[model samples]
Target: MDPWVSLDPPMPAGARARAGEPGGARELVTGALADGTKRGDVGGHLELAAALGAVVPRPASGSTATLWESLATLGAHDLQLARAVEPHLDALAILDEAGVAVAAGPGATWGVFAAEGPGVRLVARPDGERWLLEGTKPWCSLASHLSHALVTAWVDDRTRGLFALDLRDPAVRTGEHAERWVPRGLPDVVSTPIEVEGAAVTPVGAPGWYLERDGFAWGGIGVAAVWYGGAVGLARRLAQPVGRELDQVAHLHLGAVDQHLTASRAVLAEAAAVVDSGGVTGSAAAALATRVRSVVVASAEGVLAACEHALGPGPQVGDASYAAALADLRLYLRQHHAERDLAALGRQAEHEGPWWTTRSAT
Candidate 1:
């Protein structure tokens, strides 16, 4: 089978071999989880993190480019599972930036609970030698098995702090409303509201450091990589000769999807190179992330539409893997926030001037 062209540099040998397998998408995730028993975390599966070079620092074995490629590979496999795993790796990126040490061993997985939306209010109070978290945290992913979590909570009316909490503690309660996660799209990911009362925590960084850091926007772009991967997954099916007998209209749709995916990959690759070079910082980081995310999101939306129009509903209903990939990508892409985020970008662009005027020779 011919692989879809998404990244600039071709997929690595190991990743390529895995992507080429029969039922490879499901198999990799299952194998990753199974490998967890070797270390100590019987139910944990973080092999994807290590594979994506997310567990190790860029200077060590991973780079921004490698991380994005690995995320795209994972997205090609199973996106609901990919969605489940992305937060953990994103948490690692945050912790690394904050000088927080997290072991990438089997059972020592981490999660991020910084979704500071309404309905949950987690407060960190100073306790003797440590800190305790009080209140509920909404949208806590992998709350059941995560050994630790990088949580964001309101420190004051105007300040927020990031804390590292040990979920192994008895005071923390997860799955408070597991029933509410009824979306079939990412059902198994299990992102439910959590209740933490007097749960001890370690301060990760100074107040406001978490959001102010460059990694925050970098992480957003990292998520865009995953979204691109999902788009690739959808496009791969269209690339095949098996879909709908391959007509001229289908060929046109495939060409559009291929162009969209290629453009997205190139944009992401450039963004990664810029971040790795430390070119993204302060307001510049936000601008770059917004720009890359917008392009990738648009590309994904276009690919998804072209795929559906070309392939029809037969594949969606008959092919389990294809169906799941479509559903997962659709739901995961919602992270883009559509016009809201675009509007925010527009507001920023109004102050920053046009892209062509600011272009510099790299």
Candidate 2:
């Protein structure tokens, strides 16, 4: 199946240049925001994500091949630019977390609410046969723009559940979001805290539905793919022709960067095939995500360092698009979780077994 079907079409001239600007990601879909309007070609971004079945990830509707394809495209373009897009993808992950899928309107957008830090404690209260969610949910990306969200909340002392929340509800408060989301990289991404009092919500699945499924790790690898793409984008700068003035040191740096990227790409390709074949959930998928994310993160960091050292400040200070990509990639790769993720990887390796195993000739 052709994974790029939706995204392969020509985009508006200079749209990408604009996308590198602050809060400019909205232009990816440009006129699609207007009600009842269909923007030429641009309208296909989401539809292609849906059609590729990567971000949505279900046997009945999506595929890993599609997901990787989309991630590579988005990552290479601008990692930060995808911030405006990933929340919608994450919304799908949340519903899939609950083993539920609901048809949404063409322009509908969704956000994920799983930030476990100081914020609102969402509690589910019984409202006759229905459920009401009360309290605040933090790290709600695109809260101001989304029509709905799949929120995680405490159903009781022992259970957590996934809820489909309509953002348009009068009980939902998104007014204070803008003041809270000031970040250097994805500053335009409005990941804010939202308070909902007595807001009605539909439970997508039974309790503990969001994290127990295979999609959890699958979604993680998708994020890694974005990072990988960003790394590729940075590496592309080094791929250009350097005049004879280029030194052996610069040539050596470029070669090392290429090796890292090539290795990481092979790992990513293998992991995608593993996920597509199934059975890569629970600890197994987690291991895969950590390994892939680590490799990609390392590659991106190494490439960034090598490029900065060899090319110096030319691209970063003078080239607007290149500078944005470099800055965005530096920030986006922080999703790696550093030591915490490395600990998880170590544990997985210990549990899996000895790395070197010799077998008798068949």
Candidate 3:
């Protein structure tokens, strides 16, 4: 059997180095990104964000969604920037803990640190005397930077294992992410596609060490919050113009839009509270994730509809800033969690026959 796994206590700690980070730096950087950065081309900057999140306080327990939220919000770009660094801590720390390699590159982007194929997933394999890695990855947030990748690939039969690869080595092909559907919101993100060519990697620990099992819940939080932030930004800009003269229909539509947005954000805050409370990986959590992703999508659409109704004329045509902001929000609205990730809860919850029957048999 292959020997690798997600961390029992997924994710790690000791990341809090960003406070000394440039004051308002996150705001400034995202502001610049609002208009200049093209959609799907900021791989370089996203790596920095992932690096920042990775360097700061990681979660004490892997299950806690707070850590993921913190990392995602370390800045608008953090999710993509400092994501890879999460896995390499042990890859390097184990060596340090064991008095071996003192230097290791941070695997800031976790997605890039993985490999997957057909039946098997994650890191684990027993190829004679060595394990072999093979698979393709998507949305490797820190693809552009970092020294190593923690990847998951097909192991034996249908099982998977998580493995770490030192990117500095010649066997591994580490580079940039490919063209993706989602863009604009995380322009600096360099999530790319990569291949491992008979790469030499070591098993850091055991099988299924966990790279955030409740990951959907965590992803939901960040995407929801970003929507809230974007709404706030859009509202702040619209407040003045909103007060201007408007048709009765437009006024009512605007008011309704505002109320919808406000309610959506309140729900988002509640979702955050749930994550903070450690309800991030259950039936309720999955349901909540679906709800939040849906709400954010609706909110973004409403905001645009309101804007178009109110300013779709000369003002909007002339104001490039307003148009650009709307475009950015639209990119994130395409937020998608594959059906496989969504169905995870049900798959695990199922009993061979029926739960009642199984219990009776027992």
Per-candidate alpha-carbon RMSD to the true structure:
5.8, 8.2, 10.5
- Write one digit per residue (lDDT tens) for candidate 1, span 1-362: 32222356556665643233222433444455444322222143344543433332331122566566656766665675556567777777777677877454654667888886666599887878888889988888778867778999878878889998888779998867777777756656778778888987888889899889888888888789889988987887887847347779989999999789888988897887788788557988888888899999999999989989888888888887777777788888887878988888888887774465665555
User: Which ten-residue region of model 1 has the weakest summed lDDT?
Assistant: 53-62
* lDDT for 199 (candidate 1): 89
Model 3 agreement with the true structure over 1-362: per-residue lDDT tens digits: 11111112223585442232233333433443443443333455445444444443322233333333333332223323222223332233333322333234343332334434354233345677767665555445455555565565656665555566665666655554355534554455446555556766665444543343454354555556555555545654555574466677667767867776666656665665566567555555666666666666567678767776766576656666566566666665565444544455346445421233535445
Computed on alpha carbons, the lDDT of every model, listed in order, comes to 0.73, 0.67, 0.49
Clash counts for the predictions, in order? 0, 2, 54
Q: For residues 1-362, what per-residue lDDT tens digits would candidate 2 score against the true structure? A: 11121212235875552122122222223322332222222234444334333323432132554455456656666565455556567667666656666666666767677776664488888789999999988777667766788888898888888888988889999847477555666555557778898998888877886777667777777777777777777776776734435579988989989888776777776776787677566777778778888887888789889888888887677777777777778888887798898887888786573363764455
Listed in order, each prediction's TM-score against the native is: 0.85, 0.79, 0.58
For candidate 2, report its TM-score: 0.79
In candidate 3, position 9 carries an lDDT of: 29
What lDDT is reached at residue 305 by model 2? 91
lDDT of 1 at 249: 95
